[model samples]
Target: MSAEIAEQPAAARRTLERLMPQRESLRELAQGRRRVLLAARGSSDNAAIYGRYLLEVVAEVPTALAAPSVATHYQANLDLSDTVVVSVSQSGSTAEIVQTQQWARACGAATVAITNVDGSPLAQSADVALVTQAGPEVAVPATKTYLTQMVALGVLADALSSGEALAGDLDQVPDAVSRLLQVDVAAAAEALAVADQVVVSGRGLLLGTALETALKMEETCLRPVRGYSYADLRHGPISVVSEGLLAVLVAAAHGPLAEPMADLVRDLHARGARVLGIGGTPTFAELCDLHLPGPDLSEAVEPIASIVPAQLMIEQMARRLGLDPDNPRGLSKVTQTEFAG
Candidate 1:
């Protein structure tokens, strides 16, 4: 996992370069598509969450995350003729994901598969395939593949919107991620080592980062971690915040959502919850009990860069807890379900 995380900058560069030539295809696939639906599971589902925000906010398209069982098991037919349905899978063989892609194509929607394997069933079923090009990931926890998937989503966003601004920001991501991997997260790891439960919160695009971070902690550290957007947190989850609870807040430095995240940090601190802030702002750093500063970048591209330190902290916490992050108990690198067959 550590090696793969370290390889992210290079992997991101390769993924962006590979997707650049596919811009025309991406544009065509999204041409007349009025809405976007994403089908994925596990870590890829987290990537889809980011994709939802990107496509909706940047491309001005409505997006929905698909429940694969609805199509695969319930056999519910969807009117996706005017929608672009995207399947995101690492191996591209997850049965339900593949089934969803096939179902979408049959419904007259343009299907796009974002996967590492070019020859996988999901890739073959899609009208367009956007490969992450992260090479082979052997760790039970996805590091590089998850990061590269976000990069591919960024490229797709640019292609759909016909904008070069995000692409320019993405070009700098590799070096920024490389710099983040070098930062020592031992102190932050130690701070979270004794937590009985964790709550991760963010807003907008960074909510996906929060979700992935919580999953990483749960899988590797064997802790119960719940993630929510800042607004959702206040709805009911805020009542759970108290002493001995660990709260991780992700904030973008220069965005409308940044202030609310900072305010949430202060609120959590007042409630006696230990707050750890991850962002590129001085105010966020000062407000949290502990802070991990990320690379200065646009919020659109920050999701790929912000996740690095959180992954590092999870690795450190796993070691501190005497667990092997490479092979977490009761988990496999590639999960094949009954639907795949």
Candidate 2:
């Protein structure tokens, strides 16, 4: 897994940059679409939530996220016209999502496939394929692939909303990711070693990352976890904070809520929650046990940098707990919802 993550930067850049030239074509296909429907499961589904938000806020387009089962069984009468279905699948061959894509296409909607595999069933099936360059993911729970998917989809949303010029600026993302991967994990691990519970929070696209981080901590580190928005934390979530708990916040750089979110971090510090602010130029580096470096990309684009630190934190915490990340809790590499003999 270490070797896999090590080799990913080069491959990720190659795969992502290859799609830059085609941004105009994709944007052209997406322009003025009445509704964009995204479908997936697991971490891919979480990424799709952010994709829907980015499309709506950045592109000024209406979008919704649906589990494949919703369109396949629950709501068969879904409107198909002027709708583009973007299916995100790491394998590009998930039975349920593939089945859903087929259903959407049959209903006359244009389909776009976003995946890690180029020649996989999803790419072969869609009207256009947007491939992520995350390389091979040996671990069952996605890490880098999830980050790349967010990057590809966020840039796609920008292109679809504005123009090709926006995508050219996107080539700098790999460099930002590289910097983030170099963040000091030693400090973060030491902090986590003593923490009893961890609170993860973010706004907009980063919100899903907070959830993903919470899941990683629960599954790998055996840590108590909860996730919420930066603003929502003040409502009631912060009441549980103590000297033994860690508060991790993802503050976006380009979002309207960015500053207030930072202010919330400061407030958390005053209230005694040890806050580790993940995004943007953090004001209190010495106060934060761990400070990750990042580029000031759009709010939708901040996930790439924010996710790596969470991955490192989980990996280190797992090692501390004496658990093998490759196979957690005797869980198999793959699981199914149904099987046919």
Candidate 3:
């Protein structure tokens, strides 16, 4: 897992280089698309969350996260002719995801499959495939594949939007991720070593990061971690904040949303919860009992970089708890649901 994490910089660079030649085709597909829909499960779904933010904000295209069961179970025959449906899966063989892509293609939508496997069902089913060159991810808990998926989504957003600024930001992601991977988070891991539960919260794009982090911790460390957006946390969940609870807040420093995140951190701290801030301005650092090193990038692009530290923390926590992250109990590398393609 560590080696796979370290390879992300090169993996991202290679993915961008490989996708460059296909940019024109992707742009052509995006030309008249009325909306974008993404489908996936587990960590891939988290990547889709980041993609939703990118397509809406960067490409200025309305985007929705698809509920595959609507098509697979309920048999909804909605028209998707003017939509671009993207199916994300590491193995590319996930039944629901493949079924979603197939259904989208059947509806005359331009379908794209983002996967690591080249000849998987999803790749064959889509009109175009954006394969993540992360290589063989042997771990049951996806590390490199998740990061590479985000990078692939960024490349796709860049292709669709034709934004030079976003293109440059994508180029810097590899280095920023590398720098984040090198940060020493041993202290933070040790701090949370004894905690049985944690609350991971973030705003905007990092909300996906929070979800992914909580998932990783639960899968690897056998800990109960619940993730929530700050707004959702404040809606009612803040009542759970108490002396024994550990809250990890992932926020972006250079955005309008930063102030609210900082305020939440302060609120959590005042509520007798130990707040661990992942990103924000100096005020956030001051309010947080502990702060993890985070990438200094726009919130849209920061998800790719910010998630690295959280993954590292989970890996460290798994090691400290004497659990095998590569092969977590009761989980497989590729889950085969009853709905096969």
TM-score to true structure, per model: 0.97, 0.88, 0.96
Off by over 4 Å in 3: 162-165, 339-341
Model 3 C-alpha RMSD vs. true structure (Å) is 1.6
Q: After TM-score superposition, what is the CA distance of residue 4 in candidate 3 from its true location, in Å?
A: 1.3
lDDT of 1: 0.87
Candidate 3 lDDT over 1-341, as tens digits, reads 77787888888888877776777778787667788899999999888988998888887788999998887888678889899999999999988788888888878789988999999999887888998888888788998899889988888887778455377788888889888988888877877777645899887777788889888888888888898877888899998788888898888877777777777877887888888778778888888888887898776799898988888888887899898878888888777667356
What RMSD does each model have against the real structure? 1.5, 2.7, 1.6
The CA root-mean-square deviation of candidate 1, after full C-alpha superposition on the true structure, stands at: 1.5
Per-residue lDDT of candidate 2, residues 164-189 (tens digit): 33464456667776776676776776
In lDDT terms, how accurate is model 3?
Answer: 0.84
The 10 consecutive residues of candidate 2 with the worst lDDT sum are: 330-339
* Candidate 3 lDDT score at position 2: 75
Query: CA lDDT of each candidate?
Result: 0.87, 0.73, 0.84
Off by over 4 Å in 2: 231-236, 284-290, 296-300, 330-341
Better structure of 1 and 2 per lDDT: 1
